[model samples]
Target: MKYRFPEGFWWGSASSAAQSEGAAQQGGKAKTIWDHWFEIEPNRFHNQIGPAQTSTFYENYRQDIQLMKNIGHNSFRTSISWARLMPDGINVNQEAVTFYNNVIDALIENGITPFIGLFHFDMPLYWQQKGGWESRETVEAYAKYAEICFNLFGDRVACWMTFNEPVVVVEGGYLYDFHYPNKFGFRMAAQVAFHMMLAHSLAVRCYRSLKLPGRIGIVLNLTPSYPRSQHPADLKASFIADLFFNRAFLDPAVKGAYPAELVSLLKEHDQLPVYQAEDLALIADGKVDLLGINYYQPRRVKARMTAISPDAPFMPDWFFENYEMPGRKMNPYRGWEIYEKGIYDILINLRDHYGNIDCYISENGMGVENEERFIADDGQVKDDYRIDFIREHLKWMHKAIQEGAHCRGYHLWTFIDNWSWMNAYNNRYGFISLDLETQVRTVKKSGEWFAEVSRNNGF
Candidate 1:
């Protein structure tokens, strides 16, 4: 069987500034939360590696963009570092502006459309000192920063994402201790999540008011929640999980409002965030023009087997437990289950229930550790697993498109093997592998397969 993508389907991958762009302290870039966190607690990162140790995209973007073209990319997604652009999150840095302008223009010159994201978990440390997203003052400052980005690069960049996976910031920073500002408070997490949505809305409002030629949107890492069985309790658990993890951002961004059930649930738990009278109207006005979905894995949950103590602090997991299905295929390198059909399920849900907005698979790929073991005699990584992973997902994506989902394209998790967050460079998820020591870029077997897919518009 042959599968073909629609005409002009975008082909490329996604990356972030904090993860890939080294020169953390130089180039007039102020310290981000990641930078400050690493400085204070270096051991929190994998192998003691920090944000400063990245792919050096600041100095190597020209060559990197060429590598993108070599992989047959028609579009590429990378974020502008907020702290880099504005050293203090309020003042503009001209040197950073020049560097970004050059990168954007270079991508255009190489026939790759640039998709610029405003925030990718790199909050300026100064903002953290001021309560970060919890402070209404910080939210206003973020809106200003978004406005600055539009005034600076909106003319050249056609796709603008307000934030990439805002939920991760809330979950990692507040609920879990994985990210900076590590704390465990449901009240704080709810407040931060609300503020992030407000900030996103405010940025969208700013973009619309400027009448920018480009489209503005947000990227969400959507993990579909499935129940272990058809029991009523399991079904309820899945519904609640989806409400908190997926629709919390999806409904607001696409439908221009938060889910009513979510609001009632939060209120019942006394976890509602403070908001001004005009916040809802602002959110309603800031609906996205596009959506970027990052699907890595699905969440299989079952009803909680035990009751939570009344004295326990509130958490989303109180209502459910993770259900590991028997004989489920797994990505041994990454420990995530391989569920390709989840992509089609997400797309079909969007089409039937969420207005079928324009969207793309912004980040999807397999991450492997110690990839040197797979290097062939020709010095190329024979990443046949990644190729298979992508092809399986694409099959579902193609089925979704044929069934009337408004999906536009499929981009892998990343273009090059760059630094990850807390995991650092442990898991490499890229078509083009990066030799961290020599900074050498090599096209893997998956890259060759991707080139053919791009050239044929499918596989």
Candidate 2:
């Protein structure tokens, strides 16, 4: 059987500035929270490696872009490090500007479209000290920074994303304490989540106000919440999970409003964040022109069997519990469940309930620890497992597209194995493998397969 995508389907991979571009201190790049976190507690990162120890994309972008071309990438997504572009999130760094201009130009020169993301969890440390996303001041400052990006690089970059996975910032930073400014308070989490949405909306407004030529959108890692069983309680649990995790940002970005039930629940719990009266209107006016959906896994949940004590702190988990279904397939390396059908479910939900907005799979890839174990005798990773993972998901994506889902393209998580946040290079999820010691890149089996897929526009 043969499967083909649309005429101009974007076939590429995604990367981030902080993760790929080393030279943390060079290029006039100020310290991001990742850099600061490593400075304060070096051991927190994997193998004591930090943001400074990246794939050195800053100095080697031209070579990397050539690799992208060799891999048949027509479009690629990478973030502009807020700290790198504006050292203090205010002053423009000319060195950083020159570096980025070269990067964008190289992508264009190679016949690849540049999909530039404004933020990717690398908040400037100076902004963190000023209360991070929790402060309205930081939100306003981010709006200004976003406008600066539009004026600087809007001419070359056609596809713009306001933020990549805003939910990760809320869950990792405020809930799980995995990212920087780690805090574990329900109210504070809600406040940070609200303010991040406000910042995204403000950036969207700024993009529109500039009348930019290209499409502007937000990238959300939507983990479709699945209930354990057909029981009403389990169904209710799934509903709440989706509302909190998916709709928290999806609603405003696409539907131009917050989910009313979610708002009511927050108000009832006195967990609403501080916001100006006009903020809702701004959010309404800032609906996205496109959506980037990053689906790596689905959230399988069930109604909580145990009731929490009244004195217990409020958390989204209070309403449900993770239900590990029997015999569920799992990615042993990354510990994420392998649910390929979740991609189709997500697209169908968007099509049926959310107006079938224009979207694309922004990030989807398997991360494996100690991937060197899979290296072949020919000096390439025989990543057949990753190839299978992508193929299965793409099959479902193709089905959804055939069923009238407005999905545009599919981009894997990354082009090269770069530095992951605190998990710094531990879980490699790229078509091209990066050699840390030599800073050499090798195209893996998956890369060869992806090139063919891009060339044929399908399988």
Candidate 3:
């Protein structure tokens, strides 16, 4: 193989509880924010589809684990639903425990390492009603919940994550109004962001207190910001965007401190979050043992063209704007820019700027609409586009690793077509495509191709 990885390189894909597990109200699981939001605003979801409809991983994990083995997955990641494990976000749910235990044991029996995430944006309806991440009580509840998980299943899990793409949670819930409890404000966003990090630190503390056998970390969707021009304004805009979006969580996750510039910028705007002095001490405890990068696209940034009125709401956009570079590559199906080198830049940045921390490509995949349109006579998707996408990204990743990057693995965004948040199933992102109407699974060309890459440790 020309582009080979290190010995024992982990090859698998990631999944989230709310996105893949379809037994929403079954097996003694309660409602999450996704369920509640779907109930109230069904139209917000595509075709009125919601959390109750998924790939049915909850009912089919054994078969999915066999599929993982068939596709050469040595490691796989999927999160536990907080709403399922702790219906009230405090007490334990034994039925959920047995179900998760069976899933974990099944993956082990299939020779696939289990990477368990404690939270994956599936805030329990119980917690959301308590002000979600806004309330410090929610943070404490989350920490306690983390302790319960560690006590129950830490024995078999190899990796644990506190949260995933926390910036999205901050952006969607507070700044942009894309998620449940959607609001628009920077002050509350700041508070929620801080509390989330604090909550992460608390979870890390709990994991350490028990001295679990595995590593603990968080998965961040790191979007490398590229400036539109060499102009100083454009450069500054890129820096600020990175500060607010990337470093907001990355810095505190790996570095143990929020960027001084970030704090000063928030202070200048009177947007500092309400945090106790001891919170910093706790935040220091939350530094991760591993970092997971979810890179799908790069953020193209430019200086703001127009000034914001003094009466207007303060937001991240107050400092910068996003634009598409003319002639840049695009993923038309998902409407996202495709710059394969962005993965290289992200890995290089981590190597040079973030102490070469141990990390992995936790998610990098292409989502396409109506993938069935490419079905071959063999009754499988001839997704050559997706295969090329993976190869291009992997070439850059291989280059990064050759340059002494501490990247250990690459896991695709998903293993199978599953329900997405607001987009529902509009865009399919999986090596194995699913027919939701029939729950039929068909391995795509990319799946077979990836199996070869894994068996050979390269392309």
Candidate 4:
């Protein structure tokens, strides 16, 4: 069966500031959590490679934008580093303004629509010292930072993303040891999650107040969760998991309110975040004009066989145990299991529960280990596996569109090989491979295939 994407469907790739733009200390950029973490504990990063020398997008954006044009990108996504622009999240930096202006102009000159994201897992160290997302002061500082960007670049950028994969901020930084701050306390994690949502909502309000000619949205990494069995307990566990992982942000961003059940559950356990009535009002009034869903995998969950202790410390995993279903498709490179159907489930949920708000697959790609193994003699990678990975997911995405879901586009995780947090340059997800040793870019075989898809809208 031949399926074609809708006319004017967006085609492009996504990238973050910290992962792509090196020169962390240059361009009047202040220290971020990543920079401070590396300074304190250099061994935390993969191969001891810090965030100082990334793909160097800050210096090579002119040429890199051309490469994006060559790869058939119509709309490319990149984040404006808060620390780079504001240095302290309170004072605006002029050089950073000129730098981003050049970037936006370059992308526009090449006929690529610029999608700007405000925050992407990197927190300014000054704000982190002020209690990071756990303090109301940081939330207000973020709103000011958002206002700065909207005032500066809102005219050229038509799509503004408030935050990217916020759960990762909470999960990786507060609840786990993967990211900076590396605190394993559940109370701090809950507080961070609450304030992050508030910050997003506040930013949405700020953008709306400006009446910018663009769309404001949040980029969420959505994983359609599955219960391991037909039992009622298992089903409840899955629902609770969804409430925490997906609904936490989706409810406020799309539906304009927090999930009542979620709040009730947290309150019952005395884990409810402290909030003022004005904060609730802000969230209720703040709504997204669009939604960016990043789907890479699904979550299979089962109910815990043992009864929960009312006195136990709070955590999202308190209700369910993660079930790794046997014989699942796995990304051997990144150790993440892949499930194509997760995309369809995510779209359908948005349609039914979230008022079917305008949405798109914001980040989906395959990460490969030692991708050079497929490098051909003619200077291209025979990355057939990546092509297959993307094709399967796109098939499901196309099916979702036909079934009346409002998905508008599909953008891969990255345009070129770049660094990932903690893992540094371990897993490559780029359509175009980058040589870290020399910073040269080579279009992989998958890039050629994707270019055809972009040209034809589908194959």
Q: Which candidate ranks first by lDDT, i.e. highest?
A: 1
What tens digits encode model 1's per-residue C-alpha lDDT throughout 107-209? 9999999999999999999888999998999899999999999999999998999999999999999997899999889999999999999999999999999
Better of 2 and 4 by lDDT: 2
Candidate 2 stretches with Cα past 4 Å from truth are none
Candidate 1: deviation at residue 96, Å? 0.5
Off by over 4 Å in 3: none
lDDT by residue (tens digit), candidate 4, 1-459: 887998889899999999999989999999999999999998888898989978999999999999889888999999999999999666789999999999999999999999899999989998999889989999999988899899999999989999999999988998767888888777678789889989998999898889889999999999888999999999999999999899988898888888999989988878877788788888876789989999888989999877768886678888999999999989988888989988999998888888889998899998888888888889898989999999999999999999999898999988999988888888899988999888988888888899899998998
Cα lDDT computed for each candidate against the true fold:
0.93, 0.92, 0.93, 0.90
What's the CA RMSD of model 4 in angstroms? Answer: 1.2
Model 3 Cα lDDT, one tens digit per residue, 1-459: 489899989999999999998989898899998999999999999999999969999888888889989999999999999999999766799999998999999999999999999888889998888898999999999988889889899999999989989989999989888998898899999999999999999999888989889999999999999999999999999999999999999999999999999999999989999988898888888899999999999999999999899999889999999978999999998889999999999999999998999999999999999998999999999999998999999999999999999999999988999899999999999989999888989999999999999999997
Winner on lDDT (1 vs 3): 1
Give candidate 4 regions above 4 Å deviation.
Answer: 306-312
Best-to-worst ranking by lDDT: 1, 3, 2, 4
Q: How far does residue 11 in candidate 2 sit from its true spot (Å)?
A: 0.2
TM-score of each model, paired residue for residue: 0.99, 0.99, 0.99, 0.98
Clashes of each: 0, 0, 0, 0
The clash tally of candidate 2 reads 0
Instruction: List the lowest-lDDT window of 10 residues for candidate 2.
Output: 82-91
Task: Give candidate 3's total backbone clashes.
Answer: 0
Which residue pairs in model 4 clash with each other?
A: none
